[model samples]
Target chain A: MREMIITNNPLVVEKYSERVLFIDGSVEQVLIKVRDMVHRKHGLISHPLPASLRVLFSPYRSVIIGRNNGDINPLQVEIVENSILKYKKHMDVREVDKENNEDYQMIDLTLLESALKDEQVNSMLSGY
Target chain B: MKLEIGRIHIKDIQFGDSTFVEDGVLTVDKAGLIASLKEDERIKDVQVDIARPGEKVRIIPVKDVIEPRVKVEGTGAGFPGVTSKTTQCGQGRTHVLYGAAVVTVGDIVGFQEGVIDMWGEGAKWTPFSKTYNVTVDIQVVEGLEVHTHEETVRLAGLRAAEFIGQAGKEVEPDEVLTYELGGMFEETAKYPNLPKVLYVEMMITQGLLHDTYIYGVNAQTILPSVMHPNEELDNAVISGNCVAACDKITTYQHQNNSVILDLYAQHGKELNFTGVIMVPEHTTLSGKLRVADYTVKLAKMLGADGVIVSEEGYGNPDSDLLMICKKLEDAKIKTVLITDECAGRDGLSQPLADTAAEAVAVVSTGNVSHVVTLPPAEKVIGNPESIAVLAGGWKGAVLEDGTMMCELNAVIGATSEIGYHNVTCRLY
Candidate 1:
């Protein structure tokens, strides 16, 4: 079985080799920042990504994320991977400051961005 | 978007010398309607009949139900991009022949079509039982593919409705209800203190016999998109599928979507009703993920604080319903989901095929597999024995005395997820 982890922080995407992670933004601020960046990357206008987004996780395509709560369905994971490959594109980026742990780590949306570009994840976001 | 629906309450329908409405009574030129519908060569024969609210009548193997409406002052006609003509809808004046519906019956296609009982114990379950139904008994060419057969009956119903809708054109309506929602941003500015909410309506788009149409286009071919709730009120979206009969939203329900209206009722007082976002319930895993994801994306784009998601059909579509709820709730957007259950006859099974911890507020429309018994109708409109082959019926569903026993699945709109009916379930 693929490994799984559930957390409120997006940095966990790179910290573990978990195949699936459920990011619960049970807190309002954590939830809003997570949503804003995901929408922005998809070409939708929203609040600017916090300055914290700049400090950690560069070379940012390291992990995939989704906006759903609880454990992800196995079938959904497979389809999301396929959709990611279909819409995959590359952009310039920098490496993460793994040692930095400030307001930066709390709202970084790189993981959610990776999830938004993921095939199944994209479908979950775009198809409906 | 804004619209004025002029309701001309229909009290009775009868065969007459011409088609027109007089003093709440609708008169149809039966021979003329049959002749017009027979224009389609695929149709072998056509018979028009009427079933009223208290009549001892049963219309079986039903395919679709449509309300007779005519766009009196709009860009498009009745059922824009559908039976009439293609044009934008949900504006101006449209006349409605309320309390009456055009019910299509006759030949069976798949095991998905249902029964409409006009009287007796069965009448209490189906919303169609309360309508003054003008049923068309159709006979398609023998050996026709199920696809062509469904199309034949579907078009027949639309044509008949368009024909009947003409009767209300020149008459004055009994009551007029107006629905107006300014631009989304404008509404937000007007009701700045209230929360903004959107509605995500998932349609069944599995295949030929399982589909929905928006302005004459199959929902399966389109991606998730936005629609003014008024467009639906103006007959823009229509039911073209023959899934299980109990929960399918007939065209009438689409024209009179209670969820949209209820939200509109509280638009300024309690909330700001942002428009609607439509998505299809696709059959494949990838399709499901794509639509579910996009649906949330649209809701987020619209800046919704709360949303109500309603699903069509059951089983697989439950995955899409829960997925939307999960994404929205995870994003901290409150959501309420409406769907029916297949909790088995004993009601012990899980209510949905998939579930998420975030899907905490769900409205159960009722169990489709729940069985019911109906005494034989004093007069049957179509085929009585068809119940045996329906989705929830067995080979011996019809008793020797002509009484029938079947699950709620065979009854049309018994558990409408749109909140059209009063039927619901509670744990015993």
Candidate 2:
């Protein structure tokens, strides 16, 4: 799990399990992890991610999630790589109105990892 | 499996002493056909007529359009399970009246029935206008349940098509086309470098007014599964839906699915066309989730590198399309979606009820809400007043001078999601 994520939101890191960690650096090193899992054996098994999680990852140019300090979860790397491959064309995020109380925020990569884990547990519970 | 399609190109249709095809002309015994339809106790009356291309004829409240086909050498004769005994189709020889169709018109079942004009501005929108249509105007027994009325009309159309297709049995086809696909491993070995593409076809399977049938079973009761693409070509899939006319895939479109034909043209040369996945568009959220999840799982299992998904009815089914796209993209399979738009009259509203960033490659058929004006035909086939209450039409749709104004939604096959027609949209 060799990756670095840039985000100031601590809630993002809080969502992940204790085994996951966010290092304060760049995730350029995780590119190797993605290349390694590109040839993994294909399987019929699939775990459905939450709709909210899909929306969370919809607009990112890239996403990276690693394990404690610099080790990447091979499965997570594959997920992020697939997301980037499906990208058609990116558009600028809509600007929020000054009068509105809400605004867009950078997606937390750790939450995506946590959602994947939640899906796995749910799939197992349902005997998938 | 391999099947040879023998197309008897019918140039025109006329009522005559007996039913037969002579020199490309289809002469039908109108009284005899109508009498056969009356055999069903639920059907009170049946009026048969013909509408040819370039005729000033209008067929309103159209229910379904069926292409007449009969298997001459295959295990099945007509639409298996529905019109014939349960047997496999898509094998052996079948004869079709290529340029003809059986169009059913009746009282409105849902607000989704459509209008077909033979010659007018409206004729340009519907594919049925070009076909030599044998109109079956049916009247169900009074107080019949809504579902019974729909089923009665649906079966009658199939019966008429089956009856008419008999004339083509003894005639020679002007042209013949054969379609065959080998086993998975065989195809893979033949086209090792090409992408393995599959078609995930979603049919509207919700209860009344939104149903598609496979082998005479309502798709609503079936789970997501695989289907031989040729089976669909051999009248395996039947449109029982009464959705907004412009986008619904009629039985004729299903039999001559353009996407399947286009993909077959590219088969072996560009890609190894895998097969079809029949998925039902369920009404419940849980059912949607389950079906979508299963669909992608099957695609991945089949080693699909690319998949094309087509939707039937709109609204809730859009969610199923997006969900399937999300799952397929997540599995690293490229997906292309074909659908129609409900973008408002002004075209400012969101095109689909649901959207996903994963559905980046989409082919929009057309906007169903775009209003168009059609000068009334000199002869109206069905009830014209039914337009006021139809889905895409309002009370004043029929104007003072016998002209009618309505949305594209009321025209049959105007926005076929199966890529049967050429109508599309562009952002302003």
Candidate 3:
């Protein structure tokens, strides 16, 4: 498996993008070799595309571990894409006022992402 | 596998290899299944088969079974319109607060569920964003008030009478009569001569009492005690004092004095006259003709200024003049007999200028102070420049050329002034 890093908030990833992996805290050592399997399907991304194809390659979190008959590939692509589209259309990100705070901060998008993830899990469990 | 509970059917269930217990109930997925039985009269006897993993299957009566089916329903929320006191920063935009996802007009959908793979005009599939058409339900109620024609007419009559009465004087008989007839004629113009006769009679009566003790007399003798008397005052004393005190003493003092004396002696103190007894010729119609006696009586009771009787046709040939005179006499009202006798006896010929002079002479000789004459075609007929002349001529006046005539003398004298000289004519 390969690892990809996203530095900005709400980062966008192109289809079939390649990146190098690191072991532990070492930046030059290769822990494993991997690439996006669905990259060859689409050409260069001139315009913004659905988020379903992009991967949120987080270095902190581990991949979901499960051995179920249903494949996560379809769910991940569709669910992520739907969430991203909804977020963009509604312009969900906004500066929120907080009590006892000096600076205005962007609303947490992580909660919304978690909610979408929960919904996906529920849908799968409900035989959808 | 087959599963049944209380005569209901539970279908397509498979038992898993493992079993788990939760909340005092054993739960197993894909452990047992049952198909619903169709309603049939012939299938009276039926059996169910139950099977469990690693257990021998058992057969049971089909009376107990349960069936299950997936039923899907979804609800969501979207923004509709704004509901805040603060002014919105954006232009041409409305903020909507929605409790649940609603299919309404101008809604921005944030969530959706169920049947996601469908696309149509109503589906939210386009990247352009979905538009929800909403409608609000409301109910309206209305009421109306209506009035009848008779009520309207009665009200109009009352209003007119009220206005006239407020002027603070009795309207002349001819004037009152003309107005009543006019009122009636407004609704129906069939009776042409009625208003004229009433107007003429009003003028004559008004003129007659100019110098005498009579004052505030109405046109149609609406009040019996005042204009119409039930009894005659025979041998009544003629007070020379009242007659001598007249403001405009005509040179014909002897004649005027004798007439005044005769009126007093014959009628007495309670003397009342009716109809148009002294009216100038060419007056068009006998003003005294009463068409609706009841209406007149009613009007009088209602305190109307006067009443009018209309004649149907051209001349006094069918004149009810005599009848009206008698009625006024019976009622003891001062009556002025009006007739449409244009001088020459022939209806087509031009009216005689002396007709008024003659009528005045006759009235004077008959001991009557009141007599009005309508002028002849060219002499008394109204010309644009002479309208004021005609109007002002009502009072017995010596014109610029020294010709004396009475114009609206009847109305002015009857209402405001005293004596025929003070009365002025108003052309209708």
TM-score of each: 0.76, 0.76, 0.16
What stretches of model 2 exceed 4 Å from their correct place? A1-128, B108-112, B390-398, B422-428
What is the CA-based DockQ of model 2?
0.02
What tens digits encode model 2's per-residue C-alpha lDDT throughout A2-116? 2323232344455533433343432222322333433332210111121211122222212223224234444434433443322211111111111211111222242334334
lDDT of 3 by residue, A9-122 (tens): 221122112321222421011111111211212111100111110011111111111123343354223322332332232222211112212110011122123223433444
The CAPRI-style docking tier of model 3 reads incorrect
Query: How are the candidates ranked when ordered by TM-score, highest leading?
Result: 1, 2, 3
Deviation (Å) of B255 in candidate 3: 18
Going through the candidates in order, their DockQ values are 0.02, 0.02, 0.00
> What 10-residue stretch in candidate 1 chain B is worst by lDDT?
B387-396
Q: How would you encode candidate 1's per-residue C-alpha lDDT over B1-428 as one tens digit per residue?
A: 77999999999989997999999999998998999999999999997899999888888888789999887886878667667668888899999999989998865432334888888888989988989999998999889865677778888898899888999899999999999999988999998999999988888775555678898898877789899999998878888766557878888788888899999899899999998988887654455767878888888889999999998876557767888899899888999999887666666666665668899899888987677888877887877556544422234666789777777867888888888875955689
Worst 10 residues of 3 chain A by lDDT: A45-54
For candidate 3, write residues B1-428 as lDDT tens digits: 01111111111122343322222122222122111111222222222212322121111100001111110111110100111122211112111111101110110000100010012211121110121111111111112111121112112222221221121111111111000111332422442232222211212111111111112122223322222110001100011111111121211121122223333333212322122221211111112222224323533443322223221111211123334434433443333422222222122332211121112211110111122333222211112223232223124444455333321111111111112222233679
- The deviation in Å at residue B143 for candidate 1 is 4.9
